[model samples]
Every structure is written in structure tokens, then in C-alpha cells.
Target: MRNPSRTMLYSAAGIATAFILVVAVNIIAGALYVRGDLTADRVFTLSDSTKKIISEINAPVHIRFYYSKNNPQTPGNIKSFASRVEDLLEEYRMASHGVLKIEKLDPAPYSDAEDSATMEGIESQLLSSGERIYCGMSISCLDKSQNLPFLSPQKENLLEYEITRAIWDVTHDVRKTVGVISALPVLGMNKVQPTAESIASGKFAPPGPWIPFKELEDTYEIRKIPLDAESIGSDINLLLLVQPVGMSAKCMLAVDQYLLRGGRLIVMLDPVSLYSIVKSATDPSYRETVSCNLPAFLNAWGIKFNNNIVVADMTFATRIDMPQTKITYPSILDITSKGINRSNTVTALLEKIGLVFAGFFEFTEGATLKKEVLIHSTADSMPVSSFLANRPEMLVRNFSPSGKVFDMAVILRGDFKTAFPDAGKNLLRKSISSNSAVVLVADTDFLFNDVCVQFSKDQFGRKFYVRKNDNVSFLHNLVGYLSGDNTMINIRGRQTITRPFLRIGALKSKSEQEYKNKILDLEKDLIQTQEKINNLQKENSGRYSKYVFSPEQQTELRKFQEKSVAARKELKNLRKGLYGSIDRIENTLKWLNISLVPAIVIIVGLSWAAAVRRRSSSK
Candidate 1:
């Protein structure tokens, strides 16, 4: 009834047509369409800020991407990451619309590409097989150039920001100026000759510039403003005031005038500066108890910061483990995501920030400025005397939750009126034709190296710092926002791309909490049992011999020992149960992942064959 030859020819034609259609569609997409990023955080998607920066490019910029594609010794992860980097560069080139050119080079062993990479300052990694792999980039525009010597996977979160910043830097010839005013030696103290006693004590080395200050120096022209300065230069883009102590009225007036003239200011006030106390041990001229505030300016600005009060948050306390005891220092806080404002671009991507002896801020009555809290403590936080900050045990013993949140960092934007309005000649009484912004951080010691980073030395004896938290990133974000580099601010410190197993994490946490409670209860029971045994022994010692225990005492001691063993067994069982449950879940997930797709495909295939057979029989 059917012509098999004609049917076969039609089927072949349809298949060929479909294949050609697919090929044409792919070719058109490759030419006209940018690939979509479906990740939850849009990890591969170029952000709007990045697109904006790319659209503003007027001149031709070239990016030389050096990658070791042919090297067998290169790790699989590095190769995958390089592929992603190449895709990202392609996105940039597409977005630039011919303004940005990307040149991908495989610097094989002893090749000319390798020499070019070396000359461009791209760093190479040595493999176990003694082969070097290059994976970095150099950006150039006209006469300007910048090199990222090494592309580290650990810093992938900041990859986009770094690349965008390099592009901006090469295009922009002039660096912005930042003025620093501080009582503390943030710009590094000059080296002093070590005395015989100092050398013997091994505590006389002069410290270099603070890490935050040095980081700023790499990007901006840092000018150290004296504490006694009568005026600030107009050329300064931003003024950074850190731990301002004993400022003269004239200097305060100068700061006031600068703010009133629409200058951006970041003031780091500390209620109790631990860094200052440490420095005082080495330098007698430094204050033993350092507290800084701008009372005059704060009053005029309708903000309140009590220099004598330090904030203590039970929820965000940092734990210190000692040989004798483990104490939670409430004044030293490890601010988590709950404490940061996720809606603000400056702090959105920050994971954790460490602060020592931080204070809190409050708005005064009828405040005119628009206030936003960038970072704050929880409802279980309270203000305590600054002097009690160092006494961790005492603070923990006496801490009372205030049932109210406290602002640790705040931003105020408005037409700010000057605190020195009565001053004569050439001084602004209010912000000139525009609103000004001021960022107030409650602590300065967080920016200090002791709290922010861990110092280390490599095998080559090169000194480096490993950041312990997001303190430096936080500072950089604020500075970038304040200095009108909003593109970098938006791109810096992206959220981590890894998606964790939240359900498993929750289960583990619940198990841990349960175990902790059980341990506490067992310890309490053991303490009571021991006390009873001791009392019985003391009472029976007069009637019986010292070495010989009474029946009641022996029974009590036996019960206590049995209880201790039982507690141990219970804890062991609890741990075993937790692991067993996790393993079971993991195995189920593995099987599901391995078999689900194939099972569905098989079922669909059987269904289609059955339907086809039924139709043929009916025919």
C-alpha cells in the first residue's frame, strides 16, 4: 500500500533540511548574538556597569591574552578557567563594537610568543615537570600600558573588576589625588636608629606604611595633610581622615570648609584604638588610650558619636581561645552578612568584616541629611564603657542586650552647612550648588594590618599580606564610590560563584547544636555528682579512715564514672549517626544523578515504539 522508495527519499530530504537549518542558525547566532549566562548570580554575564565602561571607549585598546593551551603539564582547572577567560574577553570585544581588540597567544616552549609574554611582564608558573605555563594579560592604549603579571584562580571573584580597572587606567592618564590626615603614623614613620637596649629586646624595627594606605598609594596620589593645616588643597579628590586626635580649631574649620565646598570625606573615628595602644608600647609619645571624634562637626551635622562608648554585639562577638578558657570578646566583632546592608553596592558583595573597639552612631533631632546605615550591629547589641573593651571576661559577664540595632557605619548626603559658619573671608557657609557626601566608619583599627591581614614571607623572602577578611575590599569600595568611579565600585568584590549544598549544611549545623547541648548537660551533671561525692568523703573522713571510703561515697564515685563513660558513648553515637545520615543522602543523590536521565530516555523510547506498532496494526 505504500511506496518505500519515495518514503525513504522524503525522509532523507527532511533530515538534510533540518541539519542545514541548524547549521545556518548556529552560524547566524555566532555572528549576531552574545551567549546568554544562565547562572543564578549571572557570574558570566557582563554587568551593566561593565557595559557602560565599554561603551565609553573612544580609542582603540588592545588586550594580549597569554595562555598555555598546548602545555600538557598545565592543570585541568587552569585550562578550564582559561577557556572561561577567553569567553569573557570575547564578550568584551563584542560589546566594544570594534574598539577593543583581543589577541590570544599560546606561548609554547621556546617560541616567539613566549618572548613577547616575558617582555610584557606576564608571570609564569613552573610545573612539576619543569615546564613554565603563562596565564595573564597585558592591556595597552596608545602610549599607556598595564600588566597583570599572574591570573590567580583564588582571585577570580575580582577578575572582572581588575580587567575593567586596567582598561580605565590605561585610558585615563591622570591619577586622582587623595589627601590623608591622621594623628597615627599611617604614612609610615621614618626609621630610627636602634639603641643597644632596643636591639637586645628585639622590638625596635620601624613599621612601614599601613597596608590600606599603601594600597591607596598604588592607585592615587597620596598627600599627607598635617594635623595643623589651615587649608586643604582644592585639587584633592577625596580627604581621608583616620583617628584624628587633638586637632586644632583651625584644622577643624578647614575640614568643615572642605565639606561645605562639596568635597567627599571619609572619617574613621575610633572609640578605643587597639593599634594605638600597641604602638604606645614602642613609642612613649603615642597615647596609651586613643579615642578620636569630631564633636564640633558632628553637632553641626546633626549626628551623635560618643567617644567614651564602645558597641558590644553578642551576636557578632569574636571568639578568642586561650589555654585556660575560651572567651567571646563582644567589643571585637566579626560582622557577617546579617550585619551588612546588602542593598548598598558598597557592601553588597562583602562576606565578612572585622572591627575592633568599634563605636555606634545616632541621628540627632531634625537632622536634614539623608542618612543610610551601611553597616550596623544586631538588636542584641549594646553600648558599653570604652575602658571595659579590653576586659573580655568582664564584658561578657555584664553584657546586656539593648534590644535595639546600632549603626556602625553610615553615609550622609546633603547640602551640609559648615560648622565654622562664623569664620571670615572665602569660606563656604553651605555646600556650593551641590550636595556633599560623607562616609563615617566607627572604627579605624579595622583598617590596621593587625586586624585586616596576616603578614607572611614566601620561599624567595618576598613579603606579602594574606587578607583575613573583607576589610580592605570594603575600604576600596567606599573609596571608589566616593571618588566617582562608580563602575569599579559596582564591579568590585562579586559574590562567590560556588553554590553550596544548603540543605546538607543546615542538617550538619543542627546536629552540631544538638551535640553541644547534650555535652553541656552531661558536664553539669558530672560537676554535681563530683560535688556530692566530695561532701560525703569529707563528712565520713572523721568516722572512717582517710583512705577507706564509705559505702555511700563509693556508690557516688562509681555512678559518676559510669555516667562519664555513658556520656562519651552517647557523643560517639551522635557523631556516627550524623555521618551515617550524610553518607546515605550522598549515595541517594549520586544514584539519582547517574540514572535519572537514562531512565527517562528509555521510558520515552519504549512508549514511542509501542505507539508506532499500534498505529501500524490499525493500518
Candidate 2:
């Protein structure tokens, strides 16, 4: 006989004690800082570059997050992302150890907080009910300020990168100056064909800069240099030389001197440039072959590239629309993750890059400088002559795989000897005493407008250019690497938590290879059968129109028709088998993922129950 009131009192006391313990634990956690990032990719952990930048903060930089909480106008997904953004900011705050202060605000509609947010440049979205929802960030240090107008969920993957870049920009006052000396129309200066009306009006405006060039202008000061400039200005931080054909000896000497003085360089040299063809079709003066090289300068830098050869890879071929036909052009490479340098910070995170008429490079044997290949072709790649690359039809006819990998891009670092050491060049250092850096890309048309950008009209009929690939990102990252800004370069292509299944991928690849062989055999049979039918029909048509076909011709036609049908059936069956194998494997994986944990739990439960029964019997 137990007292129900006493038992109820004990239960109540236990619940109160548990609540107090939880509250105390939470309070202690808030006072102390601890972060455990258990994700495989360390998605929550701040990158080393970000931490380094934060650690060097001398002045106090404050970030204000203006979020609309519990507003019916705000979408649920955005609210979740807002919480993630706050957590990320907390990581930054902890990493900064007090140099970075964060202020989170919930701006109610028409409230003073909302007014403050609007003044700080945070944008607000209006709902159907006339309510405003704010989701953005504003960072300020003393007088200088930087604002992210809106934080869209579409760009959530770039949240950390955007915030870190904003902080770095607000703190840094100087922008790097990049000097360009391009033979092609990189500045897009009056290159379009003259129209009759425009000619009559005498109104010809210079063409706007290409999309990539426009993007660069947003972050860097672009200074275009003349082709025959005698000297490179000392104020330039990085020098970009594209298609440097027919350059004067003095200009080459000037470039040599610039590099010897520790200047960063990005050189785009191509053996065959399709973009040049388009530009030269209208203007003969700009019509130049893709043979441009400063041999004296390149040899001294421990780089050797044949300006007469172009690399063509079947594994990475990009399709081109030609006259009356579409074909995959091996010279225009569509480089994917497999071809990029995953270990190098400059190219590690890039997905796909498009390059036209690319060439390959190799270092001279016994070279003094250290070289690292940044982009490479597949094993089924070979170097083709520029003659084949110029003619689209001939390129396909003469294509063959060399079964070797070629280097499409590389970084050369260390001391470089001047090629004209004894040529009485004034003030020439003859060699770089300390290590210097230069990036050599074997393609020139990668940044061209026709290849890198696509134009589209919005619903309002306004036109805009969109990047077709990561060429713009690659160029920006290269310049950032040259300017010694590691924060933007390191976080541009990072994938925090997307892990792929390598084993399943390998199986799929194996199946594809088998299927490819089967398809090839079927195509051969179909081609042969069609040829026989064509000959029979040609002989019959060439004779009198009223003449009937011979018995042998009739038999041959029927046989060929039956052969075509059988080939089609076999091809269909091959595809079915290939898909079936892949589907079965996928289903097995799904079942394992759904049941493995529960199966283990049941096994453990049964073992415990049996042990308890045995112990009772023994007692």
C-alpha cells in the first residue's frame, strides 16, 4: 500500500530538477566557446585562409544581420537559411576572438529597426499584404561600409565566401591594377560590321568590353597597353599578354625585365585561335595566325611550347555547329573535374572549363625553374598540326589519339635567366635572383566573347550576358593568385559537404565501356548493309525506268532490309541490359541504406532478451 500523493510529489520533484540542470548546462555553454564540426567536409569549420584574415584584423569590424523573424511574408526555406547564416557568423565571431562583433536584429515592419536596415542599404521584399521582409547583411568599420543588398537562398552555397570577401574588402583600401596587352579585340573596340544607317549618321561607338573583362573591371583596374609599347609601367601589379604576335624586340625585352623584377605574369599563347578567325574575317590587319611566342623569353623561363601544334582530346571534346553538320571538335576542350589540378589552390575547386584551339606545353629538360602542371588532357589525347585545327572538316578526318597525357597549363616558379643576357640590353638583371611566378595557359580564345559568354533576353526584352562556363572564374582566380589574395582564391570552388560514391561511379563507367563496344559493332553492320542496298538501287535506277529488278537484286535488297531490323533489335537489347544492371545495383544500395540500422538494433535486442531469460532461470 503506497501513498499516491507522495509518489506524485517525487515525480514532480524529479521533473523540476531535470529542468534546472538543463538550464544550468545551457548557461555554461553560452559562457564558454566550443565548436565541434562533425561533417566530413568540415562545412562549419572556418577555412585556414579565413581564419588567417580574421586574425590579422587590427580594427574592430562589426557585422549586422537584419532578419525578419516569424513574418508570414517570409518563406520557410529562407528562414532556415537565415539560421544557417547566423551559425556561420557565430563561427566567424569565435574565430576572431573579439575582433569581429556580430549584431543580430529582427526588423518588424515599419519599426525603427526596419528603418535602420533600410538606411544601411539592406533591401526589403514586399509581400501581397504590403508587409516588408528583410534579409541581408551590412558590415562597417568606422566610416567605411560594405553591404550585401540581399541574401538569396539561391546563393547559400557562397554564403561564407561572400561574407569573408565583404569583410576583407571593407578592411583593404587598395585594388590591384592589371595591365593587358592583347592583339585580339579584348576591349571590344569598334569591331562589329558597319551598318548603312550608322555609316550615314557617322555614329560608330566602341564595342563594350567582353563579359569576362567587364567582371574583372568590377574588382580590378584594367589598363590596356599598346602592342609595341617599349616599357611596362612599374605601377602595374600583374601583366596579361594575350596573342602577343609580331611584338618588337624592345617590347619582348621590356617583358623580360618586368619578370626579372618580380612582376607576376599571365600569358595566353595559342597555336590556333578560332576567335581570331571570326575577328579577322572582317579586318585583314587583325587576321593573324596563332603563331606567337617570345622564344628568347620563354626558353629562359624554362618553358617550351610548339606554336605549330594544337592538342585535341576526344575525352574532352566540345561540340561545334558547322555548315550543314554538327561535330565534336577535339581542339575545343571541355575540361571537367578529372582534368583539373585538385591539389593546387588556383584550380582545385573548378567544375568545368571551356577552351578553344588549346596547345600543350612541356618543360625543357634540365631546366632550372620548378614547374607544376595546372590543367592536363586525358590519356587519349594527341597534338595535331595547326593546319588541321584551322579546317573543321579536316580536323575530324585526320584525328587520332596518341595515348598520352599533355599539359595544357602550368605554373613556373623560381629563378629565370634572361635569353638576351649578352645583347647589351641596358639595366637588364640577366636573371631573377629570387623565386618569381608566371602562369602559362595554352589557349587564347578561352576569354573571348563568342566562346565564353552567351547572350539572352529577359522577360522584359532586356538583354544580358551569362557566363557559359568557368572561364571567367578561372581568370579571376588566376589574377587573385597573382595579386597574393588567398581568401577569394581558396573559397571560390569549395564543396563543403557533397561526397560522391566512387565505387558506384566506377561500375557505371565499366558498363558504359561494354555498351560502347556493342554499339560500335552494330553501327558497323548497319553501315555495310546500307552500302549494299545503295549499290543495288543505284544500278536499278540507272537502267530503264520500266525495267524490273533482277532476282539476285531482289534477294539482296530483302536480305539487307532484314539485316537492318536485326541490328536495330540487338542495339535495343544492349541498352536494356545495360540499364537493368545499373538499376539493380542502385536498388540494392537503397535497401541497405533503409534497413541496415534497424536490423542491427533488432539483433541486439534479441540477444539482450535471451541473456535476461537465462539469468532468471539460473536464479
Mark the regions of model 1 whose C-alpha exceeds 4 Å error after superposition.
1-34, 184-213, 246-249, 274-290, 314-338, 342-345, 348-354, 386-400, 420-434, 449-470, 493-495, 499-619
User: Any residue pairs clashing in model 2, and if so which?
Assistant: none
User: Tell me, what's the RMSD of every candidate?
Assistant: 6.4, 6.0
Best by lDDT: 1
lDDT scores of the candidates, listed in order: 0.82, 0.79
- Residue-level lDDT tens digits of model 1 in 53-160: 888887999999999998888888888989888888988988899999999999998999999999999988777677789899999999999998877665676678
Instruction: Report the poorest 10 consecutive residues by lDDT, candidate 1.
Output: 508-517
